[model samples]
Structure formats: structure tokens, C-alpha cells
Target: MLKKPTSAYVHIPFCTQICYYCDFSKVFIKNQPVDDYLEALIREIKAYEIRDLRTLYIGGGTPTAITARQLDYLLSHLTEQINLDMLEEFTIEANPGDLTEDKIAVLKDSAVNRVSLGVQTFNDRHLKQIGRSHNEAQIYSTIDSLKTAGFHNISIDLIYALPRQTMADVEENVKKALALDIPHLSLYSLILEHHTVFMNKMRRGKLNLPTEDLEAEMFEYIIQQMEANGFEHYEISNFTKPGFESRHNLMYWDNDEYFGCGAGASGYINGMRYRNRGPIQHYLKAIRETNHARLSEEVLTKNEQMEEEFFLGLRKKSGVSVKRFEQKFGLSFDDQYGQVVKELRAEGLLSEDKDFIRMTKKGLFLGDTVAEKFILG
Candidate 1:
């Protein structure tokens, strides 16, 4: 018999405005076609009888962008097959602007044990600079409201490395976020994605961020501050209080199979990878017309999969177990990829503990470059 998948992710693509730096597939819809999307989502969920889903993450442009009534409707769609009561974690990604009193109530009622709120920055100026809708006051209010509504397991999202985002800006934002004392945080270095308004502005010489040196300095600074505040830098981009790490996200980083449903969602199953067509109209139509994927799909090579295991496994602070890696790949790590591993370790990029190969602190500071070494070209 086929075993049930461990996790699931549902993507909701509706957003109020597309951020200038965002590369995510989001639609600025005046009238959200959520009713249509929900029908398709139900269809997709029904097609899969994988009932023992250990975790379910409802994320997006923002899941809370829909109404409280819609949230209830969504929970009803999956409440039966999956063991919500026995589930380890259920996470929802929400925008502060979308969270209301009623929505919080619905989440609590639905057994959504965690929330990852999109609170990019507490400063209003940078919030406007990044095209984020909420301000500092709104963030504080949202946190307060969630706590009052009995949601303690909350994670807040933040971004640094904006064009004018200074060291002081990073410090202020970190301090403000820590002051909230949420159990988890995802602090990201800003990436200037192509075709975005920010990209156009940069090309026209109207925007410039701190140099790579400065950005690296910012990452180091945030790391120090977070550690000083008793937060664990669990993954390169994530920090958390003791025992509060996001289990659903951890599954993704660990390369475990998870279901992705709704527009532009990706799924990993049976050693095959696939993503849906990002264009909403096509995605909606495909789900209704045929049970087919309109996006790219491929099975990875053994080498490709092992290299992925190398890079992604190192993301954890605990790092990858050499024994586990061998078990998954049917070969010893020393037998393959050992040359590159030796070179990196000689240069102090990685360290080996009792049973794992992992990145050093300096290697983590240059994590993108560190990760690049493990990518199979």
C-alpha cells in the first residue's frame, strides 16, 4: 500500500498590490475568484486520498486575504480525511492587513496551531519602500490581537537589505520584532528580482542597495542580535525560540514530500517534482478541465538529488547526518562528492562533528556561495 505524504501546502495567490521586490506569483484582483479557486482546490484535494498528512501549511500572497467565512469554508474542505487532532502542526501565512478578529477565531477553531505573519518591517518608511501594506503600529496591534485571541505559536516575517535600509534600520527592525517576543522569525535578505518595479528603478540608476559587503555585515549583525536575544539561528534565514521552530517549513527544508495545491503551487511526490502554471486563468482552467499539471515537471538524477541533500541538509544548525545521507543515496558521502567536501573543509567552510558534515560560521555568512558549491552543474 502507498504511504500518505507527511505534509501539504495550499497557495492562495490573491494580493492587494504586487511588491516591487517580490518574485512570487501573486494577482492583484479587485474581485478575488476565490469561489472558483476553492472549487478547484476541493477537486484537487479529493483526487488525493493521502489522509495521514502530518502538517498542512496554508500560505500565499496571503491566506487571510480571504474573508473569515471563506477560511471556515476552507477548513471544512479537509477536516475529515486528515487527522487534524493528531496533526503535529498546521501553519497559516497571513498578512496583518488581512487578519481580523473573526479570522483568528476561525483559525483557532480549525486547529491551525501556528501562524507565520508577514510583518516585513516595523518602520513605516521602509514598509512603504518595499510596498508592504502594514505599518509598525499595525504589526504591534496584530501581534497583540493574535495573543489575545489565544494564538501564542506565531512567527513574524521580516526583510532587510533594502536600497536605503541601513544598519540602523536593521537594528531598529530587529529590536522592534524581538520586543514582540514572538516564538519564531524569518529574517530575509532582500533580493532584487527581475521585471519588478524595483528592478526597473535599479536599471535606471534610481535605486541602489548597500554593497555586498554591507549586506553581509547586515546578516552578521542580525545573527549576533538574535543570538543575544536567546533566539536560535536554526536555518540560515530563520530564527526561533526553544522548541518553537516551524515544523511545516522544516519539512520543506528537509526535502520531505509535501502536497502543494491551488494556483501556482508545487508538489513533490514519488521522487517526481512538479509545479502548476503560474498564470491564474490557465491554472484555474486546467484544474477544472483535466486533472493535469500545466507547469514543468521532472524527475531528478541521483547526482542531482544527492547534491540537493548536501546543500539543503546543511541549512539546519544540526546539519546533515553522514549516516542518514548514505542511507538515502545508497552510497557513502566520502565515496562521492568527497573531493569538493574536502576542499571546502580545508578552507574552513565546513566542519564535521560526530556524524554530520555542516557549514562553519564563516561559511554560513557566505551561505549563497556555500550552497552553490553543492549544486550539481
Candidate 2:
């Protein structure tokens, strides 16, 4: 049996309302199978060997949206393997509305020490446009409630580049965020994914996003505002107060192995990668019959993993150390990706330090193009 995940990700696929831009595995129903899902999730957890587990992230369609009884069932079971007192970080994704005082109490009483709130935007018009259920009042109430509940480590999420979003709107959102004085902020651009309603709206000419230049301006604006608020741009789309960066997210960007359970979750271990089934009923059926849930599996080739590592590492501002890359791959970075690395450097997209290679601000802006350059295929 595989040892306990060094990190564990639990997927709570139930959401009250699906956001227009969401592409995650989620179920929206008037009444759903939260209990059955928990049972299968417990079976999946018990299927794994518990060892060296250090982090836990309960993300979702909206985890806090689940009934408190469902949460109690899940947390009680997960605590069997995870040492809450010693776990480096345990994060739970919550929406501003879902995190009522009672829900906040449940989390605080549990091993969960961090809250990643989906406070997408403070503007009510924008929130309505994006199909978010929360408002500005809920944002303040959520933050205040969490802080009152002694959750000092809180991270709020924000999105810029919304349909018809203006620079002033972006600036105003930043101001509201700064007013909270939270420790962490994850600001992302509104991405129109293929399967999402937002994309369909665009296809039907109902949605009009900002131009590339405006989007870039929003990106730069977020960086400036967050920095001015004493937050570090440690990773793309992530900013944090000093000494409060998210450890679990860092593990992913560093390409460290982790164990994941719950429907549609993914796991990475000893060079094998697999994702669980997306459908809730199918995953439950699989878990009931086999005691494990899985949908697809792949073993990464050495070069493929390298491309992934570089791309993931470059998401960090500190960048990837050449020595570390070589240590992992058993080949010098220069010897393997030398030509492409040089071209990127020549084009002023990447820079080399004494022991590391990282994207510059320009390359960071064009991360899609820069990532493609590192691909060996």
C-alpha cells in the first residue's frame, strides 16, 4: 500500500451555485449525496498507508458549503491519520457565505488552521455577473468572524480582468482587500475556460473581457497594490504577509509528491500521476467495490517531469535553483535544457543567477509563451 500522502487534498464537489468561469469538478443539485460522498471518501482514506503526511487541503466546489454534519463526518475520519498539532499547514477552502459562525467554529475546533476564502470580488455588480452568492457585507462578516474565531492565518481570493472590468474597478477591489489587512491574498485573472458558462457567454457575444493590455495592467496593478500593502508576490497569483505563505500550495509548485482522495482528486507519488473519477456516483461506486477511487493514471517521463518542474518552479518569484533541478533529475540543467534556456535568456524572458534560473517580470507576464519554450516536445 502507498504510504500516507505527504500532503492530502480532499475534493468536496458540491456547490450551491456554479460560478460562470468555474471548470472544476462540481455538482449543483437541489438535494445531493453529501453523506454518501463522505462514506466513500473515508473508504479511500483508509485505503492508503499513513506515513509522513504533513499537509492537508480541503478544497471544493465549496467545502464550507457542505452541511456541518457532513463536515463532522469527514474531519473526524481524516484526523485518524493526520496529526493536526504537527501538520505544517491544513487549509480549507471556504466561501464568504458558507463560513457562518457555526461553520467557522467547526473548522477551528478541528485541525484546520487556515482558511482560503473565495471572496472573488467586493463589487456587487461584478459578483452578480460572475454568479457569486456573496456580497461585500458577507466578505466583511466572514473575515471578522474568522478573525474573531482566532483564525489568524487567513487567505482571501480575488479575481481581476472580469468582463467589462475597468482599471478603477481593479484598484477599488484592491483597496477593499487591503482594508481587511489579511495575511494572504490570491489574485487571479478571469480565465474563460472552454466548458464553462463564461466561455459560452463569450461565444454567444454576451461577454466582453478586457483587452490583453488591460488585463496585463490589472496583473501589474495587483502586484503593486499587494506590495504596497506589505504583501510579497512570492508566486504568480499569490501574495502573502511576511512569514505566512501557503505551505500546501508551495508543495504543488515545487512538484513534491502528495496523496489525494475524494472524487476527481489527483495524486502524485514516486513518479506516478493519477486522477480520480469526476462523477460523484461513479467514484462512490468504485470506492465501494474496490476500496479505492481512480480514473486515470500516467507515469511521467524524465523530460516531461522536467518541463513540469521548470514551469511550476518559475511560478515562484524566487525561481528554481539549477543545483536543485540537477539534484532531482540527475542531469545538469545546462546540459539538458541548455539551448532553450539560452534562447529564453537571450530574449530577456528568463534570467540566471549564481545557482538558480527564474522568469523575469516580462517572462512572468508572458508565462504561457515562456512555459511552452521549456517543453521538450
Candidate 3:
């Protein structure tokens, strides 16, 4: 039997306002069946057998956008399905402006120990350009409130290489982020996905993103600045203080299965990866009819699983373990990936010790290219 997933990811697809770059399954929080959706969400959670969960992540479209009473209902029901004591990390994604004192109090009373705020950037102009509703002041106030609420394990996300953004802007953003002294930070380069406003602008030659070289410079600068400030570059886009790394995300990079609940959520269970229907009405209807909302499910083949192990594991600073890969796949890691590994290492993109094969510093910049080589014929 496949091992039960010890992690769960709950998606709350409601947003007060959507960002220009976001393409996640989300809807505005007006004229929707909010209460009924919560009921269906809880019912879906109850459909699974209750067990101890090591990590639970409540991600967005902005979980904090709802009223405190609604949040209370969601969290209370969530706790009923999993024992709180066994939960080492309980995280909730929030918007800085949406985290009212009442909402913070609700989180404080619950088992939520970590909060990932969508700060995006400290530049107000960029914030407005990106359709983020929160300003720099709201970010500071929100962090202060979270600190007052006894939430020390806080993290904020920053976006670099934005439209018309300069290196100086990134420097300013990083300076402000460091000044906050938050325990963890995630910095991502801007990606233009299909159907996003930014992507349409780019297609029309209306968006002026930085050149590839400048973007690389910004990334390097971020890594350097973060390291100077005592933050560990644990993943490609993630930095953390000692013992403050995101355990929930680590479960993903480790390629472990997890329960993905709520509308538009994706889960991996029993060697199968599945996603729920993105539309709220569709998800609710499916859940009410069958107690599950899976829109599609695929059981990974052995080769696919092996490829995933390398793709996900290589994102970490420690890289992929040769022993673990061999033990899991019942094949020698060298025998399976010997040629690919030799080519990457020859190009100075990978290095291997006895236990692990990891990316070199240069390999970090070309992570996707390196990871793609691990695929079998």
C-alpha cells in the first residue's frame, strides 16, 4: 500500500482583489456562496480518514480575505479532522491589508503558527502596478500585529524583475525586507503566465520587463544580500533563518504525497496526483454528489516518479541523495542517470559527494536546464 500523506494543502480560492500576474483558481468574494462553500469544504475534509498530519498549509487566492467568523468556521472544522498536537507546522497565506485584528485573533486562538504574507514589493508604485492592494505601510502594520499576536514564524514574499523595475528598486525592496527582520522570505522573479494581464501586456509590447542579464543580476544580488543578512538560501526562491525553513514546502520538494483539499486544490495520494475542479460551483456539485471533487487523476509510472524525484529534490540546497534514489527505485542511481549526471558535472553544473548529487552555484541559475537532463529516454 502507498504511504499515507502526512501533509495537507487547502486552497481558499477567494480574493478581495486579484493580482495582475496571478492565474490561480480564484474568484472575487462577492455574490458567491461563501457559507455553502465552507460547508462543502468541511464535508470533503471529513470524507478522508482522520489521521495525524505533520504539516498543513492553507494557501490562497488569499485565505485571510474572508470575515473572521468564516475563517473561524473553516479552522474549527479543519482541526476536527486532524489532531493539532501532531501538526508541526500550520500555515495560512494572507494579504497584508486583509489581516484585520479580528482575523489575527482568530489565527492566534487556533493552531496556526506560521503566516505567509503577500508583500510582493516594498515599492508602492510597483505594488499598484501589480494590482496588489496593500501598501508598504500596511505591510509594516500587519507584521507588527502578527508579532503582537505571538506569531514569530512569519514569512513574506517579494517579486523582482517587475515591469520597468530597476536594480535600485530591488535593492530598496531587499533593504526594507531585511529591516523587517522577519524569519523567512521568498523572492521570486516575475513570470508572465497565460491569461494574466501581464502576459497580455507583454504580447502587445506594453510591458517592459528587465533584460535577461539584468534579471540575472537582480537574482544574484538577492542571493548575496540575503546571505549577508544571515538568511540561508535553502531553495531557489526561498530564504530562511536558522530552523525557520518552510516545512510544508519541503514536503513538496521531498516528493512526498499530500492531501490537497478545497476547490482547485491538487493532491497526491496512493501514487496518484489529482486536481479538483477549479470552478466553485463545479467543485461544490462534485463534492456534494460524491464526497470528492477530483477533476483529473493520474497514477505516476515508475520512470515518471523517478524523474519527479530528481526534478523536485534538485531544488534544495542539499540536492538529491544517491542512496535514497537507489533505495526508492530499486536501481542504482548511477546506472539510471550516469550519462546525464556525467554531462551536467562535466559542464560544471552539478557536483556529487558520496551521499548526494547537488547543483553547483552556476547550476542554481540554470536549474531548469539541469533538471530537464534527468529525464530518461
Candidate 4:
């Protein structure tokens, strides 16, 4: 018997404009074979034979950058065979100005119930500095339009500690974000990734980023303000109002398997993790020949799996479930990492109840450094 993952992620790799700090698998939308790519993506999904799903997410360079007709075609065929009653969430990522009236109509007619906007910052100058196509006014108008169209399950992404950013600037960004009244928010600090414009500028001594202490202060302010305004700091970078947490994202943090379709997408299933061909032409050719576009796959060892369990699970505020870990891996959590846990607890980095182990506020500030301590190898 084969077990199928209940959650799936579909990637759309086209964007109207590229940002300075983004390194995701994306290319300009102009002159690309958009229809051919969509057809190939559908072919790959159909090969999976997915019939029921708990969640379906369409992420992108920008999913809404395509034409309304293309969006409609993709959504319709994607959901045609899905068990809608069993699907808990259908999310699509969009830019601020991309969701025009025609596209909004397409979304309203589809099964998509959630929209994640890339509103990085509310300052128009910063928006331009970051290479974002939309301005502050467009964000407000887009949200207003989405709400008026009766779609309120919204989330926005904000980046802090940006180049030349000040504490006062972060405070104003947080204030504007809260005023939008969206149910979910993902706030991330600027990380200079390899091959990004920001990284290049940093290498040339042209990028003026905040100091570590200032960045920490910005983080603390965001957590405090979001909590004060009634949002749960459920995950390190995610906040939600009550039950609006992203179920698809939760699946990842919980270390559950899911399908990933389209170019540059990754998936975990049958104890194997795999990524598809990233180049559009390569992906289309592979899918056309074999109905799948897997470029690489790795079968995780038990030790590797356990390491990932701790690494991903520790990102959540609730942390890892000791009982669930024991049940899944058939090993006593204490026997394996009890010494490590004790050392971290002694240092005021970790705390434990009977059932779960969680990171303290001090520990969360260090983020990956604390999780790295649990790596067995």
C-alpha cells in the first residue's frame, strides 16, 4: 500500500519584476512559454493522481502576474478533480497591484480562500529601493478590493532590518501592517543571500544595513506589538489571529510529507525528498517525456530524519511533541537528546513540560543556532 500526502504546493515561477533580496527560483514573465509551462505543470500533477487534499498552495515568483485567463485556466484544472469538501485551504500568492478586478473575479469564482500579498514595507521609498513593483497606496487599495470581493483570509509578508532602516521606520511599518486588519502576518528580517542584489552591494561596501543590536530591537518590538494587538506568535516568523494559522505551512513545520509540483518545486513522499527541474525548458521537456520533472531525489536516513524533526519542529512556539517524536521514530526522546536538552535548559535556552520541549524567548532570538545544537552528527 502507498500513502499519499494530503497537502500539495504548486509553484509559478514568473514575476513581473525582480526584487533585490529575493533568490527564489523565478524569472521575468515576459516572452516566456506561460501556457506551455502551465500545461506541463498540470500534466505532472495529474501523473500524481491526486484526488483528495487537505490543502493546496500556489506560490510564486508571483502567481497573479499571469493573465486573468491563465489564472482561471490553472485554477479550474487544478481543482477540477480535487475533493473540495476535504480541502481545508486553497492559497494563492499575489502582488499588491496585480490583483485587478478581472483577476479578483477569477479568484472569487475559484476555490482559493486565502491571499498572501508581498507588501514587504509600507514606505514608498523603501518599496522602490527593494525593487518591488507596487507602492504603499497600491497595497491599501488591493486589500480593500480583496475584502470588498468577500475574501478576507489574508496574509502579508513584511521584511525588517532592511538596508539603512531605522527603529522608527520599523515602528511605522508595524503600525501600518496592523491597520490593514489582515488575519495573518509573516515578518522576516533581511538576510543577504548569495547571488542577490543586496549581497552584491554588501560585498562592495555599498549596502547600509542595521546593526545586530538594532535588528534585535526591531524583532522584540514586532513581537511585543503583534501580541498587544491580539495576534498569536504561533511560529517564529508567523502571527495569526486565533484560528487563522496557515495549515499548509503547519504541515511543513510538523514534518509531514507533501507533494511539490512544477519547476524548481520540492516534495517529500515515500520517505524520499525530491526537487524538479528548475529551468522552464528542461522541466517542460522532462514532463513531456515522462510526465514528471524530478531533477534530484534523496532517501533520508533515520538519523537524518530525526535531525530534521528537531530542526523544523523547533521553529514553532509549541515546539516538538516528545510523545509524537517517540511514537514516530520508536526511540525515547530523552534517551537520545536528554543531555543536550538539559544543557540548554541550564543555559536558559530551552524549557520543557511533560509532553513538549520549547525554545524560550532568549533561545528564539538566536533561532537556528539553538536548533543546530540538536544535530546528532
| Tens-digit per-residue lDDT, 192-234, candidate 2 | 8999999999999999899999999889988987888799999
Where model 3 places Cα greater than 4 Å from the true spot, the runs are none
What Cα-based lDDT does every candidate model obtain? 0.83, 0.87, 0.93, 0.95
Which regions of candidate 1 are displaced past 4 Å? 292-294
Best by lDDT: 4
- After the best TM-score superposition of candidate 3, give how far the Cα of residue 364 lies from its true spot, in angstroms: 0.8
Q: What is the C-alpha lDDT profile of model 4 across 1-377, one tens digit per residue?
A: 97899999999999999999999999999999999999998989999998799999999989999999999999999998689999999999999999999999999999999999999999999999989989999999999999999999999999999999999999999999999999999999998999999999999999999999999999999999999999999999999999999999999999999999999999999989999999999999999999999999999999888889888999999999999999999999889999999999999999999899999999999999999998888
Give the residue spans of candidate 4 off by over 4 A. Answer: none
Task: Give the higher-lDDT candidate: 3 or 4.
Answer: 4
How does candidate 3 fare on TM-score?
0.99
> Following a full C-alpha superposition, what root-mean-square deviation does model 1 have from the true structure?
1.4
Per-model TM-score, in order, reads: 0.96, 0.97, 0.99, 0.99
Scored by lDDT, model 1 comes in at: 0.83
Clashing pairs in 3: none
